[model samples]
Target: MKYGVLEAATAAAIIATSVSLLYTPPEPSWETEVVANDTYGKFVEVDSYGSNVGIAYVDSIDTGLRLAEKSYSTSITDFSAQRKGNWDTQVIDNRSETGMYPSLESKSGQPSISYQDGDLGNEKLYYANRQNGEWNRTEVDNVVGGGTSVGMYSSLNFHQSKPVIFYHSPSQGLKMAEKKQEWSKEILEDGQGWYTETSKCGNTIKVAYTGRNSEQLKIGEYDGGWSSENTSTKIKSDLDIDTDQRCDEQLAYLDTETEQITYKDQDSRTFGDAFFTRLALTSKGNTTHLVYHDEGTGLKYAKKKDGEWTTKTIKQGSETGEYNDIEIDHIGNIHTAYTSQKKVYHTVYNKGTTQKIQSKTDEVKIGLGLISALLLIFTAIRQEVIAKIIQKIGEIQR
Candidate 1:
């Protein structure tokens, strides 16, 4: 009977210790603020330049290309009247039917964007770059003959410190535009492309897209020259492609008619339901992060680290994350710009906030551990096992 009592006491002590160790408080909430609003955000693309973040999107109501620049500061009081953080917004191009599929990036600390000039009769590709604190817009490509449409799904990146853009022409399939002293255009592949995403790692540049006519997913890689490889993966909507420092390419896309966000690196994994999905990678730990929108929930983020995948909800709303973009800075800070209810928002995942919260949680856990141990010792005395502990102590002394 005494042994049974001692056994019960031991089980209670183990359970108490387990509960204290397993307890985890949630992380700090995301710092989010409006960047632009009022039916102006569509096809948003975000990129990080040093400690600053830049966003380019289409203004649906005004039909223009808009840009928002915000420098990240840890203190919320850094800016006047800041909710999270305020952005300096401007209209880079207000031409009619322009800014569809704006892709933003930075090279040599200057932000630039490549987008489509969507005027039906003068359909063309446009490039805009910030020079001397001013935005200079230039016409990149316009193969306007026999009803050819160019620059619908544009993707921009830098190669060897030069700006390169991958886009699709309805009559010419897949194309690339590179500016070397002057802007030049070339055909990468032959197929009506739906979505085009480009990334450059080391000496290799890769472009991933889908065929509009066949609905097939394909990737084209360029080391010295262009080469094509086909994938059996068929996406239900647009997709994002990125490469880590190790040059491991990843693809994140809306799969099965937007029922889920599917990520493919070496293998594929699906994370619930999502609408517009965007992907970014951090070289710090080779972490692949994705920002996406659920149908009824809100904006969500998922990341894979150390072979395990974890997700967190950024914000809650039925219409949040409808159109979104994700970018990671040099220090591993995640910046996301998304549109919810037609208003564009910028959210940051502050690592310092998470670390402080974790430190407090660790202190709480240590206190709980001590308390649990004391309670178990008291239970041992009540169960008459105090004598046994005393005897063990005495034996150890001998």
Candidate 2:
């Protein structure tokens, strides 16, 4: 009675089909989608298990990552709750410099975030967490460490049910902190806009950064001591990075099993005018998803799905995909959060699991729902229609 791991995207569909029949769209389509133009949504991040999906992104003008969530079984539509801090109104350091480059990770059913805050240019890192319906804030590091520049651009992830962050300090280059009884920090080397990839074994914490002195890209493995090297030519000045994601010259990947960093073959695999990179290694450890931009191509997605490398363009406009983040849901659906045309769009590929068949009865409900939704377009009432649709189909399938 139970299925094994999902080796193929189609295999996951088999599990879905077993649960209930589906109507696969003839071509790729945005079944349920939304884009927000009013808010400044740069550096977007999303995580989900089943129906519970959470999103965090920077409202640059608002000075922090806006948090939202949707906890429904069937609908793949807009967020149900936006800016959901009402559980507690706890505020963190809200200076002029506090809002940039926020990172988010959801674990143990709660989302934890990290960001940089300070006066003018004197920056320090801080963490905010919500649990048991209370939002709390803490300072992970102080500015007194001394730096070549301010310590900013943080990546937050959960390792062994504990909080860990990889952050950049101009004085220290690349640094990492893990939350235990208190926060413990480590200085690995000197670099900027570094990416953190923790091994599945959890014994090793791997990092990749834009090399400063050599101008080359570098990578290292940290486990209570030093292990890293600068092994390639200098990278271009233009680079972008996100959680476990960085794209630049002297490219590389980490072999977590062996705890070694493998440099990519740049001679063959290359890009031009690389902007930003969003990376996601699937929980299965078999596939890797990367979304990035180039001068020639606007926004692109590359994935090594099922041992084959394939790529497609997600956005074709100029200067798109500047700050992007990606996450895979319970099923093998791929969802991306990227800024294009100065607006943040959530591209959903919800073909297999979240998306379901359009039965005759279901289509009628959807048709009627659309009529009601149109009357309430651009208003809060539309969200109510979406909820009914989700409940309608959820009950039908059950």
lDDT values of the candidates?
Answer: 0.76, 0.55
Off by over 4 Å in 1: 1-28, 61-63, 74-85, 143-147, 274-284, 352-398
Q: How close is candidate 2 to the true structure, as a TM-score?
A: 0.65
Q: After superposition, how far is residue 102 of candidate 2 from its true place, in Å?
A: 2.0
Clashing residue pairs found in predicted model 1: none
Tell me the tens digit of each residue's lDDT in model 1 across 1-398.
45665677677677768877898755545677777778564688888786677888777745688888877644422321123545788788987788987888898888899988877767888899989888899999885631357887888887778788888888888888888899878887777457788778897888888987766788888765778888877777667788877787788877745458788888888877754444443334656788887767887888888768899888889777777888877645677888877888888876644555566768877877887787678776865667788889999999
Off by more than 4 A, model 2 = 1-28, 31-35, 39-41, 72-96, 146-149, 191-201, 223-226, 237-268, 271-285, 354-398
How does residue 13 of candidate 1 score in lDDT?
71
Q: Report clashes for each candidate as comma-separated counts.
A: 0, 6
Identify the candidate with maximal TM-score: 1
Model 1: how large is the Cα RMSD against the reference? 8.3
Listed in order, each prediction's TM-score against the native is 0.77, 0.65
